[model samples]
Structures are given as structure tokens and as C-alpha cells.
Target: MTGSIQRVALITGASRGLGRSSALKLAENGVDVVLTYKDNADAARTTTTEIKALGRQAVALRLDMADTGSFAAFAAQLKSTLAGTWQRDRFDYLVNNAGTGAQVPFAETTEAQFDQLAAVHLKGTFFLTQALLPLIADGGRIVNTSSGLARFSLPGYAAYAAMKGGIEVLTRYMARELAPRGIRVNTIAPGAIETDFGGGLVRDNAQVNAHIADATALGRVGLPDDVGGAVAALLSDDNQWITGQRIEVSGGMML
Candidate 1:
């Protein structure tokens, strides 16, 4: 997929979980990485070490998805990091993977909770990408993270899924507007992945895990690597023509 020309990817919230997996997969695919962590500096360092051990350069930065006011500064820091680390002004891939999770029933949902979700998942992604537009190389790829809940109904995920639904729509508009630069934008929706997300309900809870497995066509919940591999594949040169789409890495979940 990738030729001799080295590529670089920037993934937010990559200290652990799906973001960490995606960073490692891209490194394995010969792409250098710049990852961000909100508060877990130790985890971010460990991920960077892993990527470096793979013979690829990696860097970790601090980022908070809920702080849109800080995006301009973050972009400036990123610009400096790129210039110092790679001696370049642009990076080849951007994975908008930073977000928080909430699991409150709609009936109990609070205004603060909804605002926080929107701030991080919807508004944050939209403005962060806008701020970083100049630093993204022409013909680059952007994969915005969505969730399977956006398509399927789930009780406590009304707020979370709503933000992801907004992301799916934003992806199409991004693809259309960025087409002139030959950039590709798309969404990757993971279904019931066994991560620490949602307080590890899917990963640590037996009943929840069993229920997901029963509903999934593949008979199991998805792992982080399943989505990491998908991210690397989608950003590869082979998928140059595929953009403005929603690809679920859920092992054929829910039919």
C-alpha cells in the first residue's frame, strides 16, 4: 500500500485502547506517528516506546478533546513538533480519535452530560480538524472515529450516538470540501469493542459481553486490533478512492 516514501500519522487519545492499537498498527505498516494523551503521560510514553521499538519514529503530546479554546495552541505546538521531529510542515494522516464516554439512560441524562459529550466528540472534532487543516498534507487521509451505536439503537447511548451521527455527516462534508486538495475523509465506526470505554462494561462484564457476542454475526465483541488494522488499511494508498464512507470494524455485528 505505502511505497518507499515514509508517511506520518497523528492520532489523538492514543495513550491506550483503540487509539493505542491504531498507533502501533500504523507503525507496523511503516508509518511514523505523533500521538496525544489527555492525562495519562505514562501510558503515552509506553505507546511511544512501543512504536519506536518497531523502528518507527513516534512522539506523544498532551491534548484535551473538550477544550476547543486550546486547539489553536495545540495546532501551534503540533506544528513545532512536526518541524522539529520530521523536518516537515505537514503530516500525512490524521485520526480524530480523542473522546470521552458516558453511559447514562436518556431519562437520567443531564444537560451537563450532553454538553460535555457534544464539546468533546462533535464540536471538538469539527474545530480541531479546522485548525489543523493547513498542517495536513495534500492528498492526506483523515479518519474520524464514529460508533456502531450511531446506526443501531442502544438505550444509554443516545447522547454518545448522537455525536457520532454528527461525525458521520461531517465526514461527508469534509470529504467533499477537501477533495480539491486530493485529501480523503471517512468514518470508522467500531461496534461494541472490548475496551475500557464505558467503564469496561463490554470488556469486564460477563453478561454484557455475552449479550454482544450473541448479537454479533461473528459471535464476539471486537478487539482494539480489529479496529487498528482497519485504520491502517483505510489510510493505505490502496484505499485512495474510498472516502466519505462509514466502515464498521465490528466483525459483522448485528447482522
Candidate 2:
């Protein structure tokens, strides 16, 4: 481990969707990966298997982003995993991408539902970073997943978008604070993608797909890998100069 100069990234919510895609991309690019899943251990292990096929080190841990109390223990276990699996002390990148999306109208949005969104999206990001900041290497990178809904007002997503907007601002503050340590912070705001987000409506409903496709200037909904590649690129050493910015990967939607 002394002479190994490879970078390692810890991606939360890496069990599926965009996080899984990002993990695969980073692994393919020779970056070591530490990915986490909330529940689906089987799916997460499949991702790790694929990463190992890429010939890079990969490990998966159980993580629940909504449970803030477990973060310290989570961080400790992650550190142990890193030390045991990769023989490394500090990881090079941190992608705060774990979140839950809900589609509820403003009036009907219950206090419990709104709190759930705030807890996972806003509070989780804020506190999780605080907990894991020690393990992130100097001059590292942080990518917070935001949403295009934060830019354009979208109905039934008022609370979710608001929390994402908070992350946009938080990204700027993180960039400023971590810049001194050479750790760049940024947000990737993706448009509609074929993920299980919001009950997999886009993937299941042709009408939903049509509406999204018509809205998208690319004439198609985004793939998970679209946001994933953008994330991997943002964390790359190639993107050293860009920080504190929210880059939208929306396939030109809402233009």
C-alpha cells in the first residue's frame, strides 16, 4: 500500500441506479471503490463482482443514509473495510449520492413525509459529511447529487427539490471550506432518468416516457450511466479547477 498511488472513492447509496453506474465507471477507470447499500445486499454484491472484473478493488457495506445516528458506526466500519481490504488510510473521493425521492402534492404532503425527505436529502448530507470528513484524503473530491427539479419548479416534488436546492448551496460552502485542504466539492443535477425513483413511473408508463422524452431536447430520457459518467468525471483529477458548481446532466431538458 505504500507505493500504490491509485485513488479510492466511497459512494453512498451505491446499491443501484446512478450510484451503481458511477461505481462501475470509476472501477473501469482504475479507481478503487467502496460502495454501500441500504438493503439489497445481493444487488450490491453483484456490483462488487462487476467491479472486481474490472480488476480493481471493490467492497460493499450496509449503509442507511436516513439513519443519521448510525453514521459514526458506519464510518468506523468503512474505515475498517478500507484498512482490511485495500490497506489504505485515506480515501480520495466521497460522493454523497444517497437519497429517497417522493412525489406528493404540496397540500397533501404530510409532515412525516416532508421530514423524511429533509432527513435523507438535507440532514443526511450535512451530517454524514461531518462524520466522514476525517477519512477523506486531502485534495480529494465530493459530489452531491442534486436534481433539475431544483432549477425548474416541478409539482409533487416541492420538498424533494427544496432539499436538493439546499445541497446546491451546501456544495458551494463545502467547496469553500474544503478548498484549503485541496478537496473540491460540486453537485451533479441530473434530469429525468430511468431509475426506480418515484415508483419507476418513467420506466413503466409509456405516457410518462413520452412526456419526458418530449420535454427532453435529446428526445430521450437519460440513462443512469449518464449521470454516473458525469460524476466520475467530476471526481477525476482532470477536473481540478471546477468547484462549487452545480452541473446539470439533464439531456438538455427544460432548456
Candidate 3:
């Protein structure tokens, strides 16, 4: 077992949004980070710099969440990178956070759109985790990003929410299977967060934002830190005894 005194976490989609915030939060909590970006090199480098500024080791790698065929190669690259960068062969945490969101009215949702979502949210996560399972430490954490929409169906998001729902169920299976090794898995379903998701829907549409806010007991939409902090908590040692569960981090939304 390759164990570092300070653990490591690999957060995908870390160039921006919740991923970026989660990288910083995890680094602040003393976890070295391996971050991945899909198509934003400069943004990824900026995040690396920020993580280094926090006095933690950080590496930014390009990872296409839709590329299921390349996952085996990615796992190999990840192993080499982990050995070279951190002198460790296994990482202690994995955050399956790379995903896309769209609001196409179901009646017009295209096959390409559905396939894209499936690739990123379902197949990519499933295979990547499977490929990397050998490199995960005992008592490790796996955090999947689900969405509040899975619980409260909004028009135009049926497929998107459905895949997230799949991930939520997948989390349970992973937790159950990995329990013998002491690995914990859970999902974080965030509410209406103000990210670049869906062309800035929450930031631009006051009515839509307010509707989500009114639906949430917190009386406001979520920021990236809201989800990031929740993820950090789940990854922390303080979160022992919590797994195989879908945590609703939407601040009492729609209940």
C-alpha cells in the first residue's frame, strides 16, 4: 500500500465551476490535488497556480469526459503522473465531477444530445472508475455529482436528470462493492448553482433563479462553493460512517 501522510484527491473538470472550487477547498484541507480539464488549458493552469499558491501540490491534466475509449490510457497516465508528482501509487479520493447540462425541451431532444450526456455522465464515469479502482487506497472516498433536478423534474432536463439519477444509484453499488476494502462512495446532488451551466441560466434569468430560490429553503441559488464545500466534507475523515447515500446539498430545496 502506497500511503502518503497527507492524502491526495483527483478532481475532474477542475478548470472552472464546482471543480475549481472543490480543488481549492480540498487543497486548503491539506489534500494534494490532481485536476483535469476538458478543453481549457489556460483556465486549468490558473487553477494549478491557485492550488500551488495554497501551498499544495497540483497537476492539471486534460481529460475529456466523453472519451470512453481513452480511459484505459488515462488510467495509465494517471498512475505515472501520481508516481512522478506525489511519489505515491494510489490516490485517496476520487470526485467524478465532470459533466454537462442542457435544457432542451424533451420533445426536441436530439439523439446526439442524449448520447453526449450519456457518454460524459454515465459511461465515462463508470469505466473511468472501473479502470482506476486498482489505484484507489483503502478507506478512500468517491464522490459523484448528482443534481437536485433528479428529485424534482423540471421541463427540458429529463434526460440530464435521469443520467444523474443513474450515477446516484451507481454510487450505492460502488459503495457496496468497495466496502470490503473500506472505500466509501456517495453522491452530492446540488441545487440551482450559478455556474456557466446551460449558458448562465441562473445568473441571467431572474425569474428562473428566483423560482429556484423560492423553491429552496435557503432562499437563494447555490454558488460553486456550496457544492464544493459539501464535497469536501464528504471526503474528510470527519465524514466516516456516511456512504452509499445521496446527500442533498441544495440547502433544503423543494422540501
Cand. 1 TM to true fold:
0.98
TM-score of each: 0.98, 0.97, 0.97
List the candidates ranked by lDDT, beginning with the highest. 1, 3, 2
Model 1 lDDT tens row, 41-151: 999999999999999999999999899999999999999999999898899999999889999899999999999999999999999999999999998999999999999
User: Model 1 misses residue 70 by how many Å?
Assistant: 0.9
* RMSD to native, candidate 2: 1.5
Clashing pairs in 3: none
Per-residue lDDT for 34-153 in model 2, tens only? 998898999999999999999998999998888999999999998898899878778989999888889999989999999999999999999999999999988889999999999998
In angstroms, the error of model 3 at 32 is 0.7
Residue 146, candidate 1: how far off, in angstroms?
0.5
Residue 226, candidate 3: alpha-carbon lDDT: 90
Query: Relative to the unseen true structure, what is the C-alpha lDDT of residue 58 in candidate 3, on a scale of 0 to 100?
Result: 95
Best by lDDT: 1
Total residue pair clashes for candidate 1: 0
